[model samples]
Target: MSPIANAFSIDVEDWFQVSAFAPYIDRAHWHSLPCRVERNVDLLLGMLAEQEASATFFTLGWIAERYPMLVRRIVDAGHELASHGYEHHRASDQTPAEFRADLVKARDILEQTGGCPVIGYRAPSFSIGAGNLWAHDVLLETGHRYSSSVYPVVHDHYGMPDAPRFPWRTGDGLLEIPVTTVRWGGRNWPIGGGGYFRLLPYNVSAWGLRRVNAVDQRPAIVYFHPWEFDPEQPRVDSANAKTRFRHYLNLHRTEPRIRRLLREFRWQRVDQAFSDELEKACAS
Candidate 1:
């Protein structure tokens, strides 16, 4: 029952990005930003196809609307289609009503285009923290079977350090599969996702993930965006220096590291991984 033997996922978004950097860029300007989602995702799909791997693709509804064929390709290729919200907005920023509407909008677009039950969600920027815990209910009501929206590690913008490290039942019958991390000394150390995955050396991320899975027996849910592999994306203006660094750093190295990761571990779609784990638990 090893956890490292679990799933891989992709968060589909433009290279311009989200979270702390959202405020700096104008909403209108997002349209003017280069459209790389399809091309970059196709590259990822090619890699996954080469490896004969399937992963959960938590796609932005906006992207799905523009690239319905891409959504079709993901599902047709056997990848799980899931929501990453409609406009990449944080759940905490919206009222409960707004959040519900956003989730519904995204789910409808995803299910219609992908022609599959959209049962998984990962919030834009992992925004479902303590302040927005009620989002769990919205996800359940919207027909999402599981969510990977909680980071469960301290960050300036998002996290719930007290949340469970492994997948657990949240409100109602919904499953909360938090992004993976390791508790070292007193602080939570990121394994292989987001800025930590891009900024660190490949071996460091691999070792961290191995350590977490070996000790906890919980699958290390690693995530990345298609834009991470696109080194030539247009640079958006940012007032904050730290935000700029986080968004732009290590753009070139991402794909190589991902290629290495595919070679190193067994990767499957999120739901498939969950099902396998449940079967193993039952067998035990």
Candidate 2:
């Protein structure tokens, strides 16, 4: 039997732009900060090339505008280029018009810069939840084909705990491929990626993902950021202790662990890994 091919993705944003540091790092100052995303993403690209793996990159339009060559490099390497909004704003925080404009701007920039049609999106911080289900309608209207913007686990930051654990189509025919989670103790536990991938022991995260494939028989979606690979990135001194801990903890170990994950499991771009589900969504 073939191994379950899981989706591996990267959220392409810099160190200072993380939502946790929003209060401390003003958006106005973002241009003044030292940008490490290019180098970090290059490092990831090299690693993926060595491992013979491919991934979908949910890149910020802000980054793509400033670094078109980086965007081209991702496309040239056979990865999907999708949006993470224009400025990393939360979908729930924006009006429908604002959300629509953001997606349009992002898709336009990504498609122009990468020379590929942008059809997938992952909201900044996974910000699309029950309150902003209208965001899905905007996505379909804006020409996006799928989204990995919802997480089913309950969390302090963002999640819709009641949402389905795997790929499901919205009323507008846009497929919502949520980040992977495992059902345990009568609730969904986050097992896919982001800081959880760092906080949990590598074996524990692996165990959860293995269970999702072995038992649930579904493709798992795992995500991380270019910033997570840069432990030497500048720090936000004013960030609270908990925020600081969550962002910086285990940064040095991220590369090795992700390399291990790439070797241990079959991985592919989200579009390819879940093509059948996405096709069904379009057909329906």
Candidate 3:
């Protein structure tokens, strides 16, 4: 394992909330889908506990309302509980007003349910980009101290290729931690986890993260969804070929990959991982 400790975070939403299925699954019909997040979260808890690793759960307000016990369990497990928005709406898709409303509602619900201040916010789909920097001001106004919303890559769906690669104070004064990447070929490559972690070979993923930690001498922020850990989750058949491939490719491999990830990296909660930055943000 590397000497640097990385931020391990979970985007706590079910498979149905994935943007790939947004076109097919009506948000209104979300309640009807068989909920698998609780089970998956339990699995994550067990894994983290076994390794004595801590992580942040960027959970949906909707999930906290429906699963207060689960939210409390996350906090009680000594993990950080943060917001992933109220309805899982993308920041890029929402107007500033809408984003503020969602931010406030989600943070409040998470704080109330978890009995802890929810200070971090990760946009749905890593949707905060050049088009929505205003969302950062809105997040600050709504009481979020930091965000892990920008993915520094050139992706078809979501990324800001020009964004800062490490945790930095945004112009808005909120600490903005873009997802981790390895700078090679004069370009930032995605290695921060999520679908990329599942799609890439385990050795490559481990090597990239190790390079980021030991060579760069910086902590990489690693993230994934709870649903990724649950290969048996109900599949959505209506997604297009590209979406299907991006979301479902190697679901069976994700769990073992995560197990390896835990053993290889020194992982800690997002908020705790950036505790100094957080305190500085609060003071300034």
C-alpha TM-score for every candidate = 0.93, 0.98, 0.98
Query: Which segments of model 3 are wrong by more than 4 Å?
Result: none
TM-score (C-alpha) between model 1 and the true structure: 0.93
Model 3 worst lDDT window (10 residues)? 229-238
Q: Higher TM-score: candidate 1 or 2?
A: 2
Q: What stretches of model 1 exceed 4 Å from their correct place?
A: 1-4, 276-284
Please, what are the lDDT tens digits per residue for candidate 3 over residues 1-284? Answer: 78788999999999999887999999999999899999999999999998999999999999999999999999999999988999999999998888888998999899999999988999999999988889889988888899999888999888999888988787768999888899999999899898889888988778888998888888889899998867788878877889888888888889888988898789999887788888888788
Tell me the lDDT of model 1 at 148: 91
Using lDDT, rank the candidates from best to worst: 2, 3, 1
On lDDT, the candidate that comes out on top is 2
| Better model by lDDT: candidate 1 vs candidate 2 | 2
**How many pairs of residues collide in each model?**
0, 0, 0
Ranking by TM-score: 2, 3, 1
lDDT of 2 by residue, 1-284 (tens): 22889999999999988988988998999999999999999998998898788999999999999999999999999998989999999898899999999999988999999999999999998999988999999999999999999999888989999999989999879999999898999999888988999999999889989998999998889999998868899988788999999999999999999989988988899999999998898887
Q: Give the Å error, residue 284, model 3.
A: 2.1
